[model samples]
Target: MLKKYKDDQEFYSLVGIKPQTFYKMLEILKIAESKQKYYGGRKNKIVIEGRLLMTL
Candidate 1:
């Protein structure tokens, strides 16, 4: 299983893609539902911005 990346930079480093590309892939993955999406932090369930990414 793929580990949950901490942030976009880490994800980019692991996946070797640019930030815009990462967002594009994320949108596709969300549509496919093959990956899980989560909002960061303990409260305020907002779609985690700046650090948005995914895991397998």
Candidate 2:
């Protein structure tokens, strides 16, 4: 679904943020996720980018 948006304007219109900003936010999430210890629970099946998009 992410790959479907090729134009910058279209992507921004759908997501309400610049693609660069999205990637930056994703990087931050990845770092934060990496530092966290695993707890006993169902793990997320969705990729980080999808989760961020859902939040947006």
Candidate 3:
């Protein structure tokens, strides 16, 4: 089964990650976006839509 998350809170609930860690991961993904100039890989990408995070 797969689910799409609408916020950090929803993602946390679905993945069972702690609030602190969830926010940290979101922060890291945001930072990595700026550093991804030549990098291209499906696994390394962060998929956030509006407040939604897509996962499979």
Candidate 4:
């Protein structure tokens, strides 16, 4: 769903953030996700992009 918006204006309208900001936040989230310690439980159903979009 996040990939549906490519134009900056459209992406901003949909997510209330500029594409650059969104990508930056996505990168940060990916880094944090990678650094987390595994607890050996059920995995997340949503991808990082989806989670980020949902949080917006």
Q: In order, what lDDT does every prediction score?
A: 0.56, 0.84, 0.56, 0.82
lDDT tens per residue, model 4, 1-56: 45666578988888899989988999999888867735445667998899988888
Decoy 3 TM-score against native:
0.42
Could you give candidate 2's per-residue lDDT for residues 1-56 as a string of tens digits?
36777788999999999999998999999988876635445567998889999999
Rank list by TM-score: 2, 4, 3, 1
Model 1 lDDT, residue 8, Cα: 77
For model 2 the local lDDT of residue 1 reads 34
lDDT per residue as tens, model 1, 6-54: 8879877866786678667667655644333253334424443323543
Alpha carbon deviation, residue 9, candidate 3 (Å)? 10
| Tens digit of per-residue lDDT, candidate 3, span 1-56 | 22445776876676677556756667876676657734764543434422324431
Q: Which stretches of candidate 4 lie over 4 Å from their true place?
A: 37-41
Question: How far off is residue 2 in model 3, in Å?
Answer: 18
Which residue pairs in candidate 3 have backbone atoms (N, alpha carbon, C) closer than 3 angstroms, thus clashing?
Answer: none
In order, how many clashes per candidate? 0, 0, 0, 0
lDDT of 2: 0.84
- Please tell me which model should have the higher TM-score, number 2 or number 4: 2
- Clashing pairs for model 4 are none
Of 1 and 4, which scores higher on lDDT?
4
Over 4 Å off in model 1, which ranges? 1-15, 34-56
